[model samples]
Target: MKAIVIETVKPGGYSIINADDPLVLSVQEGARGETIMFSLDPDNPSLKDNLKKGNMNVTCRDENIIIQKGGWTSIVAKVNEIPITYNGKAPFNIQNAMAAVAATSALGLNEKQIRAGLVSFSPSIGLSPGRMNVIDLDYFKAVIDYGHNPGAIKATGELLPHLSVGRKLRMAAGTGNRRDEDIIEFGVILSRYYDHVVVTETDPRGRPIGVVANLVKQGLLKGGLSEKQISMISDVRVATDTILNMARKGDLVVLQADDVHFIIEYVMEYKNIKKRQLSKEVVNDDHSKEGGQNAG
Candidate 1:
């Protein structure tokens, strides 16, 4: 029997829950005959009460995540065991892990299989590209993600504080098609977490070049960031290069990119080329000293 996993609501502007949340209602309705799995959230008592009416077949709760089915409860896995949860620092990811355990348990998967799968899962470029892809260099680290909307930006912002880095730099852009205010909001939200903001253009999607970048710049200015803190580069390649170049040792670059493949390829190539250049410089320096000694 297929089961449903309902994720918990995160904080910030994304946490706005109404009296008749459609997702909650859908979960309630789905519990009529089918097995359903849901995360525990104290804020939504009505949803909890609804689930308590002997409708929900399973539930997942945090703080040493456990999956409960009927009268049987099993410890699925620890939140820290999941790499995506970043050692349980990311609350949203922990909630997601719980939901995954609940759903997989309902699907007849044993605890060992579920634990093994969670441990093996990673959010890498080859696995889950453009969704929190971390690139570690000799000096700095870069995270490329598809955070386009206000809620997504806010979630990323909340996670930034937990990362170990010197300074947080953001290379962000918005589709030219979104509303002016929405585009501006991207910058406004980024200003909270990023030490420096590089505004750029995405696919444009029918709007003129620089329109999206300018809107984001305006939003950054409105969000208390000075012009010096923000830089507008219209070209995606140039913007990517600028951010990579600006990053120093211990710095972190959060890239909210449109063409994720292009960004990844460019960064990899750039790192390789830099290594080659440094090696050549060292070889040339050694040769120059040898020639001077021979001439002397």
Candidate 2:
């Protein structure tokens, strides 16, 4: 559930750990004396054989948690514990930290209570929402998701089709700068659910937005969604409006807007139209009755 890429190690001098069974060990990493500990799973069990070896490349469970001179090993703590601060003091990313705080609050802790729990806590991963935009003009349901990673995209692909039984699902996506290829793989995973795909500009700090969209398109094609199903659009408003306009009353139009204001606007508009139509119909009926009486 965690992804980490380790640095600070040289090539070929380390032994990778390959656990015969991943569940047997209660601890993911073993600690040794103050300076040098087994920072990774012992690959081939021969790492005990070559203790004095220098930096080496280590991989386990598809993660690059290499063993090296530095003391760092990615782990998922089994229970509640203070977070491990990286580089001694820098704080966790804002989104990730907020998510952690929210999680603690969900467990019935109040604001004062949760802050007390954060005295020594820190997080190792960054959390962010995925790109959400419309993909097709021809479809009715506008599909948007928070599938920014490969596993998330795979889950969405498997799950979204059932949600689209009576509607078409449109999609839009792009890659992030930090993990472009990983996100591209996510796009490929989405092709199964998406009726159309739009490659759009995503946030990249100083990187060209168009370049990121291209990478997403490339990955989408690999998932078997065709070029016809994909296009490029920069304006999210236009993309969302296109779907909203096409939606009928019974069809759902999902978009980002002020929830309270949107409800007020829709109710006012609908009520006004209904009142006017009913008033006209009543006047016509009264006129018809008067004309009939005069004729009689």
Candidate 3:
């Protein structure tokens, strides 16, 4: 059995320390001498040379990762066909899909099975909780992800422009246990990407109340985000409600939190109430029109 290794991802490049990272080394050693390597297009020479010396197969040089083995080359699946990649708008997910396809191919799954699996797969709260779970409502869109660190936040930011959101809102908080500097870094990244931000508190881990929230606010201010663009609400539920209330049609809200189930339930209830109100308004308008016609 051959193990596939993803050597790099878009926007951020290599996520690990380097190609020779301990995890990479351990995987390479434990694969029973069979391994498959995936690298970014235009191929990293060092990684290519290393894998070549180890007699491992490699995929390189294309938007659709091309895998080669025994003088045969083939693509696993088109990026647009995979729902998780959002039609290739999400580059990170493209890499992920490619990695999955590579592994399945190594396991002797035919192209038809691999393609069928990729197209049928969908990413949602139920399927992949806290990992880019997106919910689209009639009026707006919401993304709930477990993006806590600076790098993760940056990656999330890269996906914003692709969403075609009119106004971006972020529901964010700092963990009580993280360093103040790191918490501030989160704000700085948010300031760069979001149009409006609501800062709140999570479990707090162990830090005093208001400590982490204040630090995040300070970072937003330092990043040149006006106080008008920022709002501080300590309660998670209230903060979620406030941000949703602020959102308008075609807007996007990204919530970085520990639990998104409550927020999702709240949004569903809000949408139901809106639907009922809209139905009543339509009925009233029709009645008024009928009465006017009868009087005339």
On lDDT, the candidate that comes out on top is 3
Candidate 1 residue pairs in backbone clash? none
> Per-residue lDDT for 294 in model 2?
100
- TM-score: which candidate is best? 3
Clashes of 2: 5
* Global Cα RMSD, each model: 6.3, 13.8, 5.9
CA lDDT of each candidate? 0.72, 0.43, 0.73
Residues 212-250, candidate 1, lDDT per residue (tens digit)? 788888888888899888988988889889998999889
Give per-residue lDDT, candidate 1, residue 73: 63
Cand. 1 Cα-lDDT:
0.72
Superposed by TM-score, candidate 2 places the C-alpha of residue 44 at a distance from the truth, in angstroms, of 24
**Candidate 1 vs candidate 2, TM-score winner:** 1
Cα lDDT of model 3 by residue, 73-121, tens digit = 6666667778888877876676666667656766678778888888888
Q: How displaced is residue 168 in candidate 1, in Å? A: 0.8
lDDT of 3: 0.73
- Compute the lDDT of residue 77 as modeled in candidate 3: 65
Error of 3 at 108 (Å): 4.7
Tens digit per residue, CA lDDT, model 2, 263-284: 2344345446656887899999
